[model samples]
Target: MSDADYFKNMPHDKNDPNPFLAIYMDQSIPFNEEAKAAYLKDCSSRSRQFLLPVLRPFARLMIIVLQLYKIIVPKALTSSRLLHRVLHFGMKTFVSPSANFMILRHFYLGSEVLGFIRDNVPGVHIEMNPLKPTKLEPVKDDLFLIHDLNLYNFVINLNRELREKGTEVTAQKQLNFSSITSSRIPIEQMPRRWTNFMDLTTAIECFTPVYQLFLTDNDFWRATNSLQLDETIGILASKIIGSNDRLALINNKHPMVPLTTLKAGFRLVLHGLATEQLHALLVELKLKQQKEAAISS
Candidate 1:
């Protein structure tokens, strides 16, 4: 069998769940107007009552102060690893768990979509590949949906380039032709946002290349310190690839979960906070909640 055929026919591990796999299959299906309306309504109700509206401004201010401090303070004084750890600890200790949950709730839909895909779609699996060396060390596992031709093309091209340059390429690096599904489309034709979930799956997949570029671009890293690049890229790419046919990967015509002016402003503020800091705070809050539950039980 040819190389592509092998990947297409590769055995799928039944236990693994991949959220993006659902996104891949979702493309072939028609848009569900009722489901979209229900999701938006649920989001609206949650946003209206959450403390996110009130705390967003304060979070924005804190982030600004932190960034300014990093810029103005000498690297020698600010480089203390211990001091950074302590500050992170303090933030984790004080930040309210509810605040973290409210902010992260927007992403929960992805997990829910993955669960649905696992139950409904047979033979779906998540494949991980090591990224090239960049600012981030040791490389990390990038999650990809098996049977996704678009993703397979990306992996195949990336690995081919790496191999030509004498970089060690493993079996995982090559496209599993056996796993390749006919539903896959060209990278440029990939949808940025899914109508069913209103999630930015395609945009996110497109971002893998952009992120790889950023990691290797020394000048960009030095200037921005890679701060808020995730949000920055998402917003810019979404606008540049406007919702349309041909090159347009996203269909903006679908009913989207409304992010009111205030909510958008709040998200902007939240974006200012370092991603790692927010993650740390969320982890700490989860631990605290687990302990509380244990005590109650």
Candidate 2:
């Protein structure tokens, strides 16, 4: 029987013996329950495989909303100005000054997720020609190669490129939002702030095209990388960076490129985490590496 027909006929209820649902429902299966459990597992996996492509569009939308919130929202919500200022100064002194604004924006959730998607998803497949894996290079030596974890950074770059060519966005970024409370019209406060923004409708209209462009870019890069559109790391890196050298090592070259399912996914999610969050993961990775090294020693 066809896979589609099989899934179509499978029971959707919680109590059904549906093998596809079993994978998600029964996480603790010590022993195989069905003769063809492996086949059932494959079906369940395929069902979720489409999620990446289908969700990519929505992911772009969420990212845009998150970026606007970050830029417009007060610092009190994300972090204290003191802490942010300290990090900003540190980043400027230690890393490239180009990365300071991004570091500040990275504190916001929208920028974190954008960084995550760019690194994790097939969205941004950077190429560093002459790829080679060597001993850990000090960040002080090549701070420009470091990743910037800010979503608004991407938006800023996008806007800069458009402006260079003389384009206008009609201040759609300053949209007001309206909120409905309890489905009850108090009538007096009829014009209360619906959303945090004053012109949300305009913002949405402006943001919509930008979101679609990101989705397209993500799809294009991933498709090209998987299909081996370019063998040179330089070309791949250029594809991912687009017109933004302020973020990645657009000038530097790599000897050994990281091109794998796991690496892609890891970079995507890691880039999405906040600075402290990324630091915590880095500590965990360090511990794991030490344990392995000790075992080897």
Candidate 3:
């Protein structure tokens, strides 16, 4: 598996005004107006682009619905045994097994990349405090993680418990990218599924402003952190990966969920794939450069 520093000092384009986009941007798959235009294209039935463009409309509506729903049923945002049961049931029975793998794998990879960015890049602040008001060490568990937000919560609590125990970093996000990406995951995972895959983008783009369009920054945090939709989708990336389902591995983050756990998880798939897609393009550029240099020399 490639280490976290695998791309250490790797040459990435720094032309974009946004730092994160700049880190991932490349000339070939340039993150420009053209790439943004293609963001909604129906690339292939198997490609993530296929369903995401379609979901943007309804998902935009659902954002207001989720917000109003939050206003009406605030408790649904928090931990609920019943909601977990419903989410678990909907996932296990309705979501395809291959799709589950894709969702979980996306989470697994997403966690790694998020962590990588935070570690490698600057100004991508992701700070967490230990769980306090409790004497017990963070409850040591074998949970796998799928979402970084949940991870944001877990390690805060998990390390609080592991504090001064001399334990090595066992949190899943610490693992190399290839640990999950190169594994025996099924190919052609899904053709039509990926429920929350586009939710984040939809919320940011069509639902926020009266232009009612794309969340900039403050709103993105307000929507995800304040609105707590992540808790709602945490099943696939959080519970299934940690606190509950399958998303964690490698001590925890790098581990795999039992196929049985898919019966009870919900998560996103596109954003992470988009990140990986850019990284792959970067790798391709390097390979091409190597070939040209070798021939010229």
Residue range 209-256, candidate 1, lDDT tens digits: 223222222321231322223332223222322321221222221212
Candidate 3 structure quality by residue, lDDT tens digits, 1-297: 111132233455656343333343433442222223223221222333455566456655655555455555544434223333443444344443333333344444444433432333222344532221111111111111113345455445444544555443322422223322232223232323444233223322332322112222333333233222223222322321223322221121212221111101112223333434433332333356557779999
Tell me the spans in candidate 2 whose CA falls farther than 4 Å from its real position: 1-44, 74-76, 79-297
lDDT for each candidate structure: 0.29, 0.31, 0.33
Instruction: lDDT winner between 1 and 2, please give it.
Output: 2
Which model scores highest in TM-score?
Answer: 3
Error of 2 at 55 (Å): 1.8
- Candidate 3 matches the true fold with a TM-score of 0.34
Each model's Cα RMSD: 20.2, 22.1, 16.2
Clashes of 2: 25
lDDT of candidate 3 at residue 292, scale 0 to 100: 74
Consecutive 10-residue window with the lowest summed lDDT within model 1: 130-139
Question: Residue-wise lDDT of candidate 2 within 206-297, one digit each (tens)?
Answer: 23333223233333234223212112222322243232222231222231343432222223322322222332232333356557779999
